[model samples]
Target chain A: MNIRQKVSLLLILLSIMLALLPLTANRSFSEKPSKLLAEVLGADVSVTVDEVAEFIVREDPDVRLIDLRPADVFIKEAIPGAVNVPYSEFIRSDPDTWISNREVRTIFYSTGNSEADYALVYARGMGYNNCYIMAGGITEWVRTVLDTKFSGGRITARENALFETRRRAGEMYTEYSSLPDSLKAKFLESKKFSAKKLDGGCE
Target chain B: MKFLRQYPFVLIVFLLMVVLVLFRSFGGNNFRYDAARWAESSVKGSNLLTVDQLSAMTGAVLVLNLGDEADLPGQLRPKTVIMRPESITGKENLRLIRKHRGPVILFSDDASTSARVWMILSEMGMRDVYILRDPGAVAE
Candidate 1:
């Protein structure tokens, strides 16, 4: 073949490879669309602040709390044990690192419901069935679980249990939020800069 | 070989278009959830009413209690309509919502239930829907 023919053949091959990439190499391009509309219409996958607080308190290994806020805002104040996975970084990040396991109840939250909702849908679209959004997000968390104060004389056993949970959760939030700035900074710094170093393997 | 040389550009464009269509059909989450707009609305507190604020509002506000009737506070009974979250469907609920002239507030001992109710109402195009800040705070 002539130089022009060779060039054209190469271009055709390149085009064909590109056409097949989505089905092979770029697997994400083949994900099913989000079922959020149907899910919302049928049922909500919202987790309560109290439930999340309980998870933190119990140190539930099966539960993963993801904060979908900007790093700066997340660093300022966040539910303890929350990993900052800002919305922008979500699409680029690997799903396995945060949400591949169906057993883990991965809950997403933000300053409000929006970011969490967005992350929930994204995770659901990626086929993560255990994903949930923190209802009302941090704002509600602050107002409900953090600032909660039990009152009134009459209460049921169930109500008492709920109150006790809230009281404990509230104390946790206070203690975490009230830590000295230097200590908080050091703690945050310790958790900063995630880099998974892959060790080289030999046969 | 001759055809490839003659129509190289066309072949490339056609392949590219195929790839685009494939991605559109198979690419993740065509249902895009706009977080910015949701954040803006959430920040505005358009659909959220704290328990304290709800108590202060003096009007014929209809509080839709999603909790069991037994769990609902007696003080709220005068203006409360108890309904299960699963039962918040059909035209009957829509008519009940439409009948209320004042703001319709959703309250449940379970915050998740109330949040679901809020979402259902909002999805159904009901206006002025709000959820209580905390289910535990409903009594006060």
Candidate 2:
């Protein structure tokens, strides 16, 4: 066959193969299952609630806390600097929109441990290595950080420092949780705008 | 032969596409289920099995313990296979999971570990796999 005829035949064959294949537009886990599993199971994938509290007290700019509870629940009470990206919404949308900043350590938490762990796995499966979970979730935060007390005992310098961090973090949590709905809404809106700006969006 | 000589570029492109398609089709160890489908099932809570539900299952159930063997409940001891969460996707472990005829349940002392392991296994398209809803129940 001539060059034109041969080229046409090849093009037709390619088109047929493409048409017959069950191609999907959705993204799948790119990393091998074994490698991803090991990474997810690693100790570094989880941060204690105390560490999170310290982050809050320090106002660490490099850390981002993600609350994976419903919007209404999040509005009622959340970690001082946490942004609400409810678990349902988080899994439904592209994670990149929320965790695009690779330089920022994104920590996920829910009322309990399950959702945060699920998000960590999902994020890591999609190759977002910066993602981590707040071990024991918000429940542990309430237990250890918010409920901390001096109890009239002699404290070491290290213990005193930890108590101070927890106290400050708890106070910040209470203050943020106590804000009026209108003010809270405004604060959240501003935070969202800042996050967008950080993500390089003009809007 | 003349067509091959004149249109080598087109032939090369066609061959490359075919090889790529074949490689993607049968060679890679990528996830079988898409992210959306896995997310949907997870949201619906179909991937979780409570302790009560686990106790009710009659058939041969393979319990893959991703925690200490001592932490596993007495009832599950007979059918439990101790496994490390990190090594769950290892060749032998994966082969055993694939060969198991009954439902494979993942158990860990930490609920988060179980949850994370469950997602990884599910995305790999392993069927009839579940995570114990509360790992604490194993201690009970």
Candidate 3:
């Protein structure tokens, strides 16, 4: 065969192979088998609002909150110290950078439960047993921690203690959210992430 | 350039096939867009009650506390009833809900619990069921 004929044959063969690649192995998109779904759903992979609140209040080093909300919402308001990894981005990107530490309790949250539930299931399906969902999402944090109130004549020491804790947490949430734009900007400026330059032995 | 001119059809077909393969492999499912759009618009506040609105409702409002008793707020308005979400299935709580002809406001320590409760009550065909917005911030 002439040079042009040989080149054309190679190109055609390569194109055909590429076109058939997706179909060669299992390719149909479907939810995991029922047993896998059951295992994920039945697992104790949920963290309560109170637990998350305590983590934020105490600034626990071992707890990491992952907000799965959109970037716009996250940029406007998010839990303090929480990182935004929107569900789409989480699904597309490598999670190692965000969730590599086995010791850190990575709690995923969205505006509500469903998105976080999906993220939890996805993570668990990928063998990430250390992942957890923040039950009820950020909305729950607002209602349970911020809007709590005592009423009627009933008063108990334990209840009082709980209320005080909620009160403190609520104040923290309010104080953070109510900060002036300039002050928040300054704080954000201080928190800006600067990439580290790598010094290596590459020659 | 000579090869392209001589084999335009083959080149175009090869490029198209390559593009298709790359897209099928790298382009994520449309499900991502649907899920994101669903999430962005899912938290509807149509049935939400703000502090001012609740205060204005006066006798018509019945606040149901669906969280732990320990975390009750410092001062809840009158006609407030405390009960776990599971307790809602009981005849007593159902009766209390039915007794209130006006709005039955659901609240918890967090918006998440209240939202879940709101969904349950909403699905139960209850009318005038509203969730309490966070008092610290204005209702969105």
* Candidate 3 lDDT tens digits, B3-109: 55566565676677778766644443211111222222224436677777777775566888776554334445456788776556456776788678888988776
For residues A2-104, write the lDDT of model 3, one tens digit per residue. Answer: 6788576657767667566634321122233233344444436778888887787788999888888887677677777777777776654445556767888
Please identify model 3 stretches exceeding 4 Å from their true place: A1-19, A23-35, A181-203, B1-140
Residue A106 accuracy (lDDT) in model 1: 88
Best by lDDT: 2
Q: What lDDT score goes with residue A89 in model 3?
A: 68
Model 3's CAPRI class is incorrect
TM-score of 2: 0.86
Clashing pairs in 2: none
- In model 1, residue pairs whose N, Cα or C atoms come closer than 3 Å (at least 3 residues apart or on different chains), thus clashing, are none
* Superior candidate under TM-score, 1 versus 2: 2
Q: Write the per-residue lDDT of candidate 1 for residues A1-203, one digit (tens) a residue.
A: 46686566666777676666534221231132223445643445888888887887788999988888888787678788778777666644555566766877889998867556646655664467798988889999989886777788888999888778877877777787777767887886786545555699999
Top DockQ hit: 2
Best first by DockQ, ranked = 2, 1, 3
Q: Which ten residues in a row have the lowest lDDT in candidate 3 chain B?
A: B29-38
TM-score of model 1 (CA atoms): 0.55
lDDT of 2: 0.84
